[model samples]
Target chain A: MNPTKPTDDARKGDVVSPTKDKGWFYTDTVKDHFFHPRNFMQDESAYGEAAMGMVGSPACGDAMKIWIKVDPATGRISDMKWKTFGCGSAIASTSMMSVMVTENGGMTLEDARKLRPQNIMERLGGLPARKVHCSVLGDKALRAAINDWYRRAGQHDNIEIEQGRVIDATLKITDKDIEEAVLDGADTLEKVQAKTKVGTGDPSCIPEVENLIRFYKEKYFGAE
Target chain B: MRDIYLDNAATTALEPRVLDAMLPYFTERPANPSSFHSMGLRAKEAVAAARGTVAGILNSREDEVLFTSGGTESDNLAVVGIPRAYVAKGRHVITSAIEHPAVLEPLLHLQKKSEIELTVLPVDRFGMVDPAAVVAALRPETVFVSIMYANNEIGTIQPIAEIGKEILKWRKEHATPLPYFHSDACQASGACPLDVEKLHVDAMSVNGSKIYGPKGVGILYLRRGVALDPLVRGGGQERGIRAGTENVPGIVGLATALSLARQEMEKENARLIALRDRLIAGLLAIPKTRLNGHPTVRLPNNVNISFLDIEGEAAVLYLDAEGIYVSTGSACASTSLDPSHVILATGLSYEGAHGSLRFTLGKHTTADDIERVIAVMPGVVQKLRVMSPVNLDMKYFA
Candidate 1:
């Protein structure tokens, strides 16, 4: 789609700005979710009993914390709430993710865990190229919350951890660490190296590090 | 909704007077200046009169000014054109790190092609480039120095006159006319005094849009004997430096706008400074907000502030909804997610740079507009902060 020109749905007053094309780059679904976010936790302290998962950091300009209430009997997420410190994309992604998990009497923890950034992005009529990383936060935080729930319930073996190590030696730099670096606004190889030192020690991992940077950048911020 | 525009630094509404001055050129006087007919002579004369008006503002010779299509083209002509003309004399060039991409990109292109040896001097925390540093960077081969009169994003004004004096002293001592000084005065058109004679600059750039004139027109002041290779080659327009058909309407509007800006500069700056200070003070009053750029030695109409833990783009959108127009560090609200390079150059972290906001006042901006922004900002910021995941204490865990 030509992102510069406003679509019919975009011109239908969903956007409040006088600049008609301000949110034209975004899909109608993305704009809808951004303007009217669902399951946004206005008061962070209100969800005390919910299992929480956090990702990204304020130092990098985008961080998100998701709270989920799981039903012990059915392993379903009964309620979800989140707070995000980022752009419209990050907030909308988390809001959409929360609604997706809890709607229709909620989804099982396993099904929620199966949900990917791609899935959330697809539901939102696709995000802008640069905001794909913003969508990634929702799934990662959801997985972390699910893990936290399992840990609190003493279900140690049920906790699923996706290990992603970019370098093979004692200097533990994982792909997740690189993703975090990208999320923290490290858009270049030099910046990512400064943040994670991923390939400084292991020259063999440099190519892979470069590849991962490209991968995540494309995954999060690339044109659909 | 009552709309309050504070993004004049990005672009300003065309003044009615400027528009009125340009209307005749577009409608009645639509003749090619190149044509020898009476109508064309009238068009040509109008252009010359506008040129004289611009020259008057800069304290320059009327023939010294060359019209182009705004600041970017003027910048390109100076940065790329000067080097191409002076390559035999030297290949080294000097510039500041915080210049607009129009200046930096062309220089970078030259460097990438191995056409020039480039040295980018760093700015202080307040975004001021030191004169001593510029002097130190000079070499026998250094051909040009392009520094901005004032930064667009941060609003910090450079001491162009001081830097010019230092360069002149160096040239006299070396007995070589090697390094020519250029300043992009696009943002400084109305807010700062720009006398090329007083500043001792060889070349300077100005655009019409920033001074409430028409867009798509700019002026590059090339002092006598400072030769630059033409960027656009056509019918020998702009003294063979920039060749194209003259934008008569745009030129007329530009000249009118510049003359008006120069005449009203003192009064306008004082009024803007008061409004700017009030906006700045009110914004800084918010908890954990740090003012960006030089506190006092900045543009009278510019106010840049960073609100911790809240995204600048989000705040901008929120403020836009509240009928207050502002801009953020984000790149045109597009897919490019990198934070502002200008903010980062000042030793601010990526987060701080990304979360920064710029509010640039203009002629129509009133005290009430500033107050409305001040009143609405705190609440918008609070709402975003409440929604932010970053704990004020700086602790995050999964």
Candidate 2:
């Protein structure tokens, strides 16, 4: 398993990594899902169908999409598909997720919540240390997709979610605009506030003002 | 299959001879070099001999060399220490836009403590910092100017001696204390000659890992009149600049590696230069490919290019599948999806930045390795381009 020498059993896409000799390290189970990525597309015309596409997170470094179709008759999953914009483990985990749903004959909201990263990795031999979270995203994405399906079916009352913090926004303030403002005697935070006619609405204006304040604070005065 | 390692700027394989030299220090003659006993005496002699060996290569006195954990710590000590020590004289510092984070981040941290003004000079498309621009950017309060001897990513060699001359002239005319200049020569150590006096720098940071030694050892070369505020406390090792028990094996390996690398430099650099050119030529032969760094002024061992309409990560993974290891940009910062600051400073577009890959050759890299990359690269780029969001037909290069 030493990386300096080639392994006799080395195959395409096999990662014989630093931890390879340790039996705990991952094998190439991702090939099954990568070559034949199962449930790759959604049922476009199904009833009670919903889609959720998520991009980067602090935890997982890439994006993914999940679509679920619920059968109103059985109150269960009719069909589901996922498209991943991430690592090999992400693709494999999502592929396995579709199979898990199929085997279960659709998912109950409780069953969907029970889905874990460990279950996906166990089925896929195991994920690499850094990529364990990549598989975790599939389960989270599945729950989100199912929740979206429930919401579309007017079942929002069953879920509880917390809202993130909100702050004032600003607009139309580019780096060039800030530079021009500084040139026009906006050397301090108070000067910038007075000079630039920026309001708390557009997303770009606040960050620009903050950067000016930061620079001025470092140079002539102190940060607020 | 065997993977070809082309990320020498990130780290290198430990040289066997250096490892052999370090073994006795770790096993047979283990003792604290700071102690006064017989075992300690021998250990102290070993350290002094190692210091002399490294000093010979840089043409500097052994007393000037202060060991640290690695390049980052060395840089932190040089940038923060000099500025903090000389704050009463001036608080401004100047550096280039294309310097490694080792130099840039510490300067950024120093900005928080004092009324410090940091001027990051811009670079041309080739990532070379102009000496004249540096002079123009200098202010009365500018106390230090930090720049890299060579770039790690695009491999552009900075005009270090020319910049040194400009700074000297400015100091003489103004009749002010000269700004201490520090260069992080970690990447440039083995690739280029590290003559401290000829470069006319106050301090320079050198890393062992880049020169085929173990990872945790480095040197900060502080010229005799350059004052520094100590970064660490307790035990009073590294001339009180850095305070910790000596990493004896790491230090021995570093000294051995530096001596060997300095000896073989000219021959090794020639070998790398030829291989690098071959890599660039093969890469450019493909359609819609643009070279990032200066063709001639760049490091002899570094080749960086951007393939239009292809995702760098996708191309990297494809190459990885073929047992050929390369990088999208600086290996240290590549974990983040944002394109490298070095690439962006060269005035490449965000897409252009994302499309870039750096292949840094080393002492181990061969013509065969270049040939392997040449054979596999075009196909990898083509496959990734076909699957990419942007159409390859659109010309993106400026």
Candidate 3:
């Protein structure tokens, strides 16, 4: 049971209210999954014959990997588990995703592949807006895992690679290029341009290029 | 459930003695010091005495101490006002990267407006600013230098007196008093030495809340003949440096708290150092754990450590569940989605900064509390680490 907290003065992280015991910024369902994550994979080596999906990075704030075993006889998920190096929101999101994909004799692989971050948010009573971007990278992680499952399951036709948003329409530089540039130690717009030639042809997309650099830096390097 | 408070660096609860001294001024003799009545005279007298108390601790004149709303305003006044008042001399300013945002943000805003050319000096791995580096950054146009007496995140004490001596010698060589030296001593007020003359700082900012006094009250000590443009423009109060109706109660509480702190400084510092070391040693015993700030040069009550593989927000929340309160430098814990600037400035990897936790001892902290933390923290870290996907090398950046 949760300790009753006064909701009158709840700021984004106002856990220490004036008149009550400490309260969490997250909902009770979110805290439950964070503290007691369902089907958490403590050691991956023991899980045996599962496809894994990973996103973000362990070096940064939010990163996670999910593993699932498909029941070949029924065409449903037999086991679902995850490991994460993220905040309360990210862990809860992934935990809820694992639960949703496998509960009640498991959902079919086609159904699990269609799951989105919004569905996870709705199930956990909606995540904080600030967390929606970083924490829900779990949705990307899950999609990667399902794609891996398709390859591992010999359903090669079902594997779908992500085509990230295009920032430079002229050079056809996608946002993934920007992320790779940041991971390769390119922090500034000029450095990213030097590496990827992003926005070289379409100078008008400079602003968008700058925004993507900042986003990738925060997502991959935790830079302000 | 066990309850313990360890986040003293963020803010402290008011001392009962401080609250006792402030009670009468609030409900009993409530009158503006500006009014020409007997009650007003008493209020004025109280404010003057509080000024004297703050000045006495800093070894400065009562006239030099200007009271304000709190540390932020005091910092704003010193960081912004000092350069502006001396702008005719030059338009250059210097500060350290590890300085509190109260000092850093204002200087940044000034630079953004092209009001001044700013140079942000870097710090060492232990978050110590180099005095020589500071001196090297100074130019003929340098109008001001601001650095904190102690850092809020890591509790690292800057070599302010050494830097002060360098600055004084530089001024002598250059034959110019263009660069005014300022220090934000809010976190340093009660724990460290704040004698302005010994430190050779032209100005210093001290806060009430950080010293176990009432919040919303602070003082800016401007050395004699040091001119600063006023920040708050109203009523020409505080010698025109800061203006507004004085917070008589908060001010009185601040003075009392500082005096109490001064009286007990030696004994309290000794007690806290013993407990702090015990906490640090216990935490470092964990595999892949590292301390954040300087080993011995930090505040007596501060203990900051990074637990690898697990994020700081998760640690803080899990500790909170066990009724042990603390704070962290992780981006996950921040609304801005960035880790602590102080931690980053110390050259910590993103993983290290995200995993950093700060536990500050205070008047209420005890040996049992430290023991409880040592006991609870290991299990918490193990739980989080087992669930985490990370296998950090401790040196990897991304």
**CA lDDT of every candidate:** 0.83, 0.72, 0.83
Q: Flag regions of model 1 displaced more than 4 Å.
A: A1-32, A42-49, A163-209, A212-224, B331-335, B392-398
Clashing pairs for model 1 are A129-A221, A132-A220, A133-A220
Predicted candidate 3 versus true structure: per-residue lDDT over A41-133, tens digit per residue: 966787667888876565547678888888878879888888888777778888898889888999987787666555776777755544554
Tens-digit lDDT track for model 1 on B50-132?
Answer: 99888888999999999999999999999999999999998999998899999998999999999999999999888899999
Docking class of 3: acceptable
TM-score of chain B of 3: 0.98
Question: What are the TM-scores, per candidate, against the unseen true structure?
Answer: 0.88, 0.73, 0.88
lDDT at residue A61 of model 2 (Cα atoms): 24
Best by DockQ: 1
How big is the positional error of residue B118 in model 1, measured in Å on the Cα after superposition? 1.7
What digit string (tens of lDDT, one per residue) describes model 2 on residues A124-181?
7655433443454566567667667667778888553312211122222334334434
Across residues B1-398, which tens digit of lDDT does each residue of candidate 2 receive?
A: 55799988778999999999999998899999999999998999998888998888889999999888988999989888998898898898999998888888888877766557789999998998999999998888888999999998899999888888888889889998669889999989888878888887889999889879999899999999889998899898988878998888888889999889888989988888999999999999998888998999989989999876655655666677787878876211233334688988988765566667889888888788899999999987765443322443434467
- For candidate 3 chain B, which ten residues in a row score worst on lDDT? B329-338
Checking candidate 3 for backbone clashes, the offending pairs are: none
User: What's the CA error at residue B143 for candidate 3, in Å?
Assistant: 0.7
Order of models, best DockQ first: 1, 3, 2
Tens-place lDDT digits, model 3, residues B1-398: 65899999889998999999999998998999999999999999999999888888999999999998999999999999989988888999999998888898899999999888999999999999999999999999998999899998899999999999999999999998758899999999998888999999999999878779999988899988889888779898898778899999999999999999999999999999999999999999998898999999999989999888888988898999999999987676655455788988889877677888999999899899999999999999999998888888956432
Model 3 spans with C-alpha error above 4 angstroms: A1-22, A163-224, B396-398
